[model samples]
Target: MRLSFTTISIFLSLIRAPGVVSQTGLAPKQFLNLPLGEVKPAGWLHDQLMVQTNGLAGHEHDFYDYVAETDWTGGSSYYSNLEEAGSYWFNGMVPNGVLANDATIQSQTQYFLDYVLDHQDSTGWLGPEVNTTKPRYLWGRYPFFFGAIQMVEANSSLAGRVVPALHTFVKLANTMLHNNGEGLEDWTNTRWEDFVMTLQWCLYDFYPDGNEELLLDTMQLLKSYGDPWEEVFKEEYFPKTAVENLTNPFPFLTWHGVNMAEGLKALPATYRFTHNQSDLDAASLGWDLLFQYHGRPSGIFAADEYLAGLEAARGTELCLVVETMFSGSYLYQVIGDPKFADRVERVAYNALPATLTGDMWSRQYLQQQNQIAAKNMNPDPFPTDGSYSNVFGLEPNYPCCTVNHPQGYPKFISNAFVTSPDKTSLVHVYLGPFSTQTTLADGNQVTVTVDTLYPFSDTLTTTIEAAGAFTYRVRIPSWVANGTISVNGAQAEAVSPSNGLHSVSVAAGTTTIVLNLPAEITLEPRPHGSVAVHRGPLHYAFDIARTQKVLAQNAQEARAVDLEFDATVPWQYALDTSSLRFQYSPPASGVLPSPVYDSGLPPMSISATACQIDWSVAGDTFASPPPTSPECTGPTTNITLWPFGATKLRIGEFPTVNLTA
Candidate 1:
């Protein structure tokens, strides 16, 4: 059922299908997403993706039982009690395989896609659940198709087969929705937005032929049955304190951290269909409240399982980190807000990498901002998580993060650059080393190349080549106070950005525009009178030397082992903020290290004067919140801090020291 690439492209162009704006009068998207592989990673980003390919992300399907022997591939049952792990792996692996263009990964992806498509039942139900009286959970299909559709977009040859199969499933989904959402319950009901998002993609992009009304109806019905995220986001319903501390029986679904992350864009996604202002307002309010109450220094909200509090010791789940990145990217594309892009970069650059090892083999189920050690915690801070939750392992406390973490950077690369609705312009939403090629509305072939260390280095060089002139927009992060842009190395001019984006009239042919955004060291005040170090997008953390012990080894890969880390030196430090200095040492060979996140390889660090403080561990496991105006217990000495993502053991939030005290 596969169609040739030429046929699919022609078919897409001829369709008057509701793209950004559907025939049902949906609101137009501010920015449109490019296909999966259109934006390619380069430089440090490329190295990072390669490292992911050589690590768990690329090999999960080969050895991981959840993915390797899952029911999605004709096995009897999923490894985990929840049947979504295979889908998670697929959702992540599709982009990684397509973006990396790795043969082995691509083959694995094709094999799974072939099996799933071929196994579709006559009832139009996808997956291995069939003919049992047991309640069917359609939630797994949401992530599965999320990856499937990307594969279709990346490799258009899958369009004929995948599109029709998707259309069939939509028909069944619409039927089920009409019957009061038979299978939509619990988690599925709370997370209906994921299904709605997929439906919108089909209605707008694929032209579900005569099923437009059906798709629209299904979206409305799903919203009616789904969690009232819009209503819950209101000030009264939104929990200001930690879920555990609240006396009222708060809707756990609303407070569940991963759900909050995925639900952040739920109303915004609904706004596209309803075009209601309240939906948009509610969406924005939810974003603010989530962070205001539960936000961490690493640009993620505390949700070790449910919404934790603002305390630095509270753990944030790895699933929440990647989901927040996705939701932020979605909000930026739909709402066209620069702040959303900034948040996405913050999570990607700091929290995402901080959760995983440098090799991407091992990962923490939960990461703490003031983490001093990566070991099983007996009296852990997380209200809903277990002891192994904070340890670095293959499956630590839960398998969800293990299967789900792969999508973080791969999807980040996919959404790095987006096109304007009319296709007359391209916007660099999230700055990184990537390039994009797309045809503009005027029938001009445009290629944009961005080369820079970005987030680590302040300079970004963008080379634009087009058959004709077009508008080029680069996002000016909220952090940058004075950014400069030069045309072809000409005299630099101050960049006056509107709504956090600076636009330039790019002429035809190759033109190099170098942008310099100088950032000054700043301090973010935290709870308990502690402060976090920040310069540009990277968060600075005190690099604590740690000794790692392999608790267990993976049967498939010896290198992929469960790790327990203990700080070798003291991690209790109070910084003298006045003495902080930013340092940059470019690579001697002018090449970034293979694993950019490896400690000391980032080539950028901060030197500051600090002294060991009397900070003690909570329950002798996690570091307690920084003491309020604590006296220094040791002599002051110069200390070095690395990027938060570079250090596995670190103190991201430090107490301020008063030398005269």
Candidate 2:
């Protein structure tokens, strides 16, 4: 008999490991990310995702040809697009959100799921086998494994098939490794090998019966071939040298920004399987080094194919943004680290939005932190990126970002709330509007509704409906200096979030927890003595007026209409740092409107007195922030700055002048 999704969810809730499997390698009792649709995104987050579904992710076939396949799984077409389409189907656009019950989404997503589950070979290969005539091009298999993770997370009915299939595939792959050292080839040396480790750990977590032997054997196999990152990082980054002077011995791993970002989770995953403190240290050190030299104001590392230095004009690939986000999501689940969640939020709030059009119709292949133009140029700011790298259009330079970008928003929303290992507590990781239903370890079911305009307004309220009492934990960001929590109406004096999390006993029958998170504005020093402004999690940038020019249909792909944005107003401004102040316009009293862009009618603005500096342009693009302590050239003027994502073209990192001095 066919059962409802809610019924299936309840059944899965009761289905525990016979003893305690570490096949997934994650300690389920510590933290559990709910199924994809269990926690639904609402408010502006919901609206943004809806726009994406209607814009490109929903109608992907209308614009691109490769991902339009229902049966074709050949390697000739980029498989990342299909994987991306699957993620979009499961997470954001298709089966959930505004189009939750849409028949087209239901059929398309179900067919894709069926394709993998029904077409598995007797040998247990999941997706289409590329190069059947020759040895499997091992590297290509990794993405399907990566993509399968979303399926297993979203569809409970498929777990029985997916889990066993994963077991068969990993064991087969392991055997192939033994026969001729299959995966130990050149491409496997890159961090992509980490997926094997992750997949094994997932299997280990799935089977309570214990597959420890197979797990360790696979780990050892990958370790022999994968990048010897811990040793290389410790030697190259020892004494933790400054970023600008740091040179990577393995240019293959370090120079490729997306690879570097994707590799960040490898050590963290290693720590999960081995519980090695050194692995954890390596993960921590890796983060320290990335932000030191190649970091952008948007909480991403600079890479326009290579690790460009910290000049804001240098570009960051959109692929790296989504990949790093995916890495952080996994890292947080395995280690229960709050810092990983914080990194996720910084990228989500700043970089994700800045790179996409407000309507989600277009995106940049590479976006600059101090961008003043988004047009094609003779010499792109990115040394390796193509001419159309900065164009706000569909599939500007490559199709990778277009296919990969959909996972960021939906995954962020899915991870907003998670259950503790024992299922007696709920943890609200990121600030967003969403609701989730989960069964506690004690067999009581609970529902949580998060209500707020978080990352915009500081106030957040969560209402709990449950059959019994449970511990409700709220993540208090380190950036929040004055955070307070109240239950029902009385202040929860016993709850101190000094350790980044606050837990309080939430009784059944509509218990409400109100959080007051106060933010403070501060100037973050940037490269070459410039500074990017920040208030709590949001980055502030000069709101520049943009005049979009539709580029002449010059590319071979005539269907791909590109756009160029020109900043009409003067962008060479140096802030009078002392005159900065913020004036907030709170959300309207009842039923918040469609999408609020950080403010209302008068427009919530951060005003400061500033003067035009001698900052010039590099070709048509805004030049790098004038070297340390720029000298003013024009009289002081009042200027407004808004959240970095609100403006199409912005000066995010700016030079500063001591006007009084």
The lDDT values for all models are: 0.84, 0.69
lDDT of 1 by residue, 1-661 (tens): 2345575455434431333333364687889999899998998999899999898878887777788744444555553322588789889989998889898888888887877777788999875653345666778788888998899889888888888888898888878877756878778877889988888775555656777777777777777767778766877767776778664232357678888899887898899888888888888888888888888778888987888878888889999999999999999888887878998899999999998999999999999898888898768677788988888889999889988999999999999999999999889999888999988887989998998988778999999999999999999888886889999989999998999889999989989999999888999888999999999999989878988899999888776799999888888889888889999998777678888886787889999998988988877678888998888788988899899999888899989886644
Worst window of 10 by summed lDDT in candidate 1: 14-23
Using alpha carbons, what is the TM-score of model 1? 0.94
lDDT of 2 by residue, 205-319 (tens): 6542366677666665665556656744553543232233444544245557777777887777666655667877787777767777677767777888877877888888887
Each model's TM-score, in the order given? 0.94, 0.87
User: What are the runs in model 2 whose C-alpha is more than 4 Å off?
Assistant: 1-30, 70-103, 130-135, 183-187, 197-202, 207-212, 238-247, 491-495, 552-560, 589-603
Clashing pairs in 1: none
* True-structure lDDT of candidate 1: 0.84
Candidate 2 accuracy as TM-score? 0.87
